[model samples]
Target: MRRGYWLILVATILLVTGYHLRFQAPATITAEQGTANLGNWDFTHQGPVSLSGDWLFFPGQLHTPASFLQTLQTTGGAGRAPQTLPVPATWNKLYRHQSSHPLAQGRGYGTYALKLTGTGHSSLGLVQQPACTSSRSYFFPASAPSSQPVSTLGHVAATAPQSLPHQQPVFSALRTRPGAPHYLLVQVANFDHRLGGLCRAVYLGTQQQLFDLQLQRLIGQGLTIAIIFSMTIYAFAIYFYTPHNRSSLWLGLWALCATLYFWTRANFWEQAFGTGGTFGFAFHYTVEYCSLLLMGPFIIYFHHHAYRTRYVAERLLRGNFAAVLLLCLAVLVTPVEWFTRYYTPLMWLMLAQLLLAGYILLRALHDRQKNAVRLGISALPLFFTIPVDLFANLNGKPSGSYTELAMVFFVFMQGLVQGRRLGLVIVRSQHLSDSLAEEVKHQTASLEEKNYELLIARTALEEANRDLKALSITDGLTGAYNRLYFDRQFLIEWQRARRERCPLSLVLVDIDHFKALNDNHGHLAGDQGLKAIVSHLHAIFRRASDVVCRYGGEEFVVLLPNTSPDQAAAAAEELRALVASTPLHYHDQEIYYTVSIGVGGLPAPGPSQQPLDLLSAADRALYQVKRDGRNGVGVADVIAADIRA
Candidate 1:
């Protein structure tokens, strides 16, 4: 069964991966020797083409379109010749004259120029998405009369301060004349991040095709984020409503952090809120670092709760959380350049976290812990993807949708595990309820026989009779006093209250929408909900003289000695609020419920009045509360036969 389940999960992952790959635009032609000849290419048929391969690279120079054109014309291939470097690669990887050392460091600025030849006169669109710290591109069309670029993205400067970094994607339309070469110049500056120059692919297509592609990418990212956020909400709901499950809380926090991290990476904010300035840039990196750092600790915390290696896991969790806090603090206080230099260290830290997680999982498996295999199955995707993502980040490459898809699969598996656990709990509860009912019946008969033979019974028999009597009067499921006990106790309390000239109160509580809960969530859930409400009743009315009883299904009665009608009403309101606020969690599902409380008391009972009158009065008030909408407290003074809310 387990092997079959795993096979199904793997198949689902492959299906999702295939769906993600379907949207990717494939490149057919590669630019060589600083120029791409597209004479044989058809833009309408090919969709979009990637401008990847050798491009003219001018190290340490930030050149404009007009200046570069003038320089090339004036120099006429003189001493200041440009080198051919691969597009979609950082300048830090560029070597000088067969030397091992790089030609330029990551901190410097540079210009990249690409020439397009043999393209027929057709209106075209260019898309550039640079993953470096910052960049600006100028598109000079062949049909233009002047040296000025027809379209420009931001303003690239020689110095860091003068540069306005364009982190968002840029799209430009070109009107190309027949039999002319077009010049595309991109100037990049990187004073902050670890990689400079064109790190992402540039594409060319028709204007509408590029726009449609961009829209599709945005929609895909938006849908993925939406699914992650929904899972976050579900995890949080379980954490808050369930009795004890800190794992869900950490899981929710981790999902939230992952969502925010991906959102910024996708540059969705730029589309929604427009171009990000200096503040936006800083905010982006800050959120990125904080979210990434926090995710590790959050996952560790989640694993700590899911599996028990607490002593070691607890120490690890504390250290990781503290380190994350310090790193986040550094990101907030220091300049982007100063903090970004520690990217290698951050990567190492993340790697360590991954190793620690592996250790924990191994330890759990060695110990033969419950649900260990299931957890391993769920975590398989993350274990595979995190390393791949880390490698991509290290190499300045764009990460794929593997991590997102993995998270989706992980959440699905978690839901399945939780559902199975809930099923087990329900089955166990039903079995226990059945066994307890049979035990109670047998004990009741024994108690009756022992009472008749008390003279013949020994001391042990007397004690057993007492234990059986106690069990007979108490509810099997909720452990509250039963209705029979309440009936006899209520009369005794009423007579004593009348003799002592003191008030005696009765608070009747009923669970609202109980039948609906049972119908929707099943009888097992209803049984658990009943027990939860009874627990609240016992907690609130805990005086030694007070008696809590399960009057019937989804209805409970509290006998408060020396409590007035007003006092009982206040207590009932407190109980009502408590029950309404605390939801019953069955696995991933949170079931919220409320109670209608009816308070009835005799402040000074007349000689003619009976105990049944008080019960009748409380029932009437309960009816009134139900009629006036449930989840509220209503009061009735039996002496005056008046009811109030």
Candidate 2:
């Protein structure tokens, strides 16, 4: 088929899809007035109710929910997906006129308002009421979070009021009998971006329900991840599989490093699958950039097209790599909200990346070379579509399927080009029989030598990897187990202690006014000071079981698997005095840095015990010591007693 025909075919499909989405009917439900009244309703078990009919009216500003979705899906998409919204976040955000979470592509943005009115319980609280846990059909008995029971509406159940703010402000002073229609008024509208949005409301007078929602903001995140993965694969292919060898081997190796860093070292897997939180959120957000950084060398290698290309591309590549690394470090070493403002800096970085890709593609197009043009064309859709896709999702007009279709086209085109080129080369190879045989022999011998060397390297790598993994747990400066290692060891030790019913002590060591020392001298001198103190801590960490690491830039954590608070304090005090006595000379000032230590011991460690809580208790004690005076140790329980007194 002609390529033009393919384009026309795809265009027809899109038009048909859009036409289908543009018009759709609203599902109707019978109602008495513009209201509904019922008691003890459960949406979770019953799912979305179709309350669409004559009395079931929406304000003129907004269309019915079912009809609205129908129009959107038919015009812009198919029932394949309805753009997801972030659920369980602050409702206060929903009211903003232009407020939008990340949606499909960068091109989309706006806000929509939704309101529901019924003459019934407006008392559903903001706190997540548990969905029905019982397997009963349609309904269950009413109950409260407390041990007490509550009223029931038909088979539907309502829970007693707890210390939760009412989620809905609408008032309802009415009731309904079986088959009798009631009134319901729902008003919804969007202020910007074509007034495009979703306004869904449910009145499940009765039925079983399950909750399903798209975390809209999460779509931007998922798209970013998918792009990183796709781009990485492309880079890997360019470096390892492409006929161009100007710098292929090195580029491939760097791509491998980036892949490892993204998957393992950077904690992308942890955030997506493991524990989700500030750490998860932060990692999840930045891992894409880290992956990009890792993929940079190959981008540069391929961007230059050959070693013969200008020095500036190579220089720019290094500069970009360094900037990314600095950004990563800055994020880690600095306080939150400084560099992570979500919009400004992040948007700028995304813009920079777009420009870079644009320049490469434009340059490739101008070259008039087949391979260069092919490479550029292969990556064109991704470069244009991914960011646009993110912007749209954030704006509530997502097109994930369109993006996937573009990607499929790219892969197919690239594969065809590569296969054609390889086939031609194979047909031309018969003329150089002697040369080909010699080349094969040389390659075979080289492969054998490489295999032997690889075997030796593999053994050495395994042993080194094992040791490095152990050392990774240890804080480099402190020569003790670091936070990452401490976390792993803490779980193991805590479980053992729980099983054995034993005590565990944790101490937090904060250097009093260490920041002042750095201010006085310099960061380099301060680093040396920390190294000296870590050396001391290392000497004291005698038992194989005890673990310690730099908990904060200026703080250290010590874990005693089985020790009392008193014992922990004694250890802390000894380290403090040793640091005080061991003064170091930095710059003109012969600086002395003292340590303020807080010690805490668990009466018993168990699954329920949080290691951070123990650290927090120690931190509170350390605060008390700092208040009393610097250069001292305080135990959490002891300090608590003194504070009480």
Candidate with best lDDT: 1
> Residue-wise lDDT of candidate 1 within 164-234, one digit each (tens)?
55567878887777678887887777766667778888888889888988887887777778767876887
Model 2, span 1-645: residue lDDT tens: 357645854664464335333322122343333233333344444333444322321222233334443444474464343222332121223434445533221112222212234324322211111111100011111110112112111111122111111111111122332333322212222211121222222333221111112122134334333433544465456545445544444434434544444353323465347633334434543554445444444455445553333434557767876876777676566433244334345445655755675576566556654566666765677676657765653333323444443444444444445445544544544333333333333323325777755544443334333544645665554444577877777778777766776778887888888889889788888888877777777566567778767786888887888887777778887888888988887766677778888888876665555666776788888899999998898888732211121
Per-prediction TM-score to the true structure, in the order listed: 0.66, 0.35
**TM-score of candidate 2 on Cα atoms, chains taken together:** 0.35
lDDT, candidate 1, at 133 = 65
Write down the RMSD of all candidates, one decimal each.
Answer: 17.0, 29.3
Q: Score residue 73 of candidate 2 by CA lDDT.
A: 46
**lDDT scores of the candidates, listed in order:** 0.77, 0.48
Backbone clash pairs for candidate 1 read none
lDDT, residue 403, candidate 2: 44
Task: Give stretches of model 1 more than 4 Å off.
Answer: 1-15, 75-81, 95-103, 141-153, 308-313, 422-645
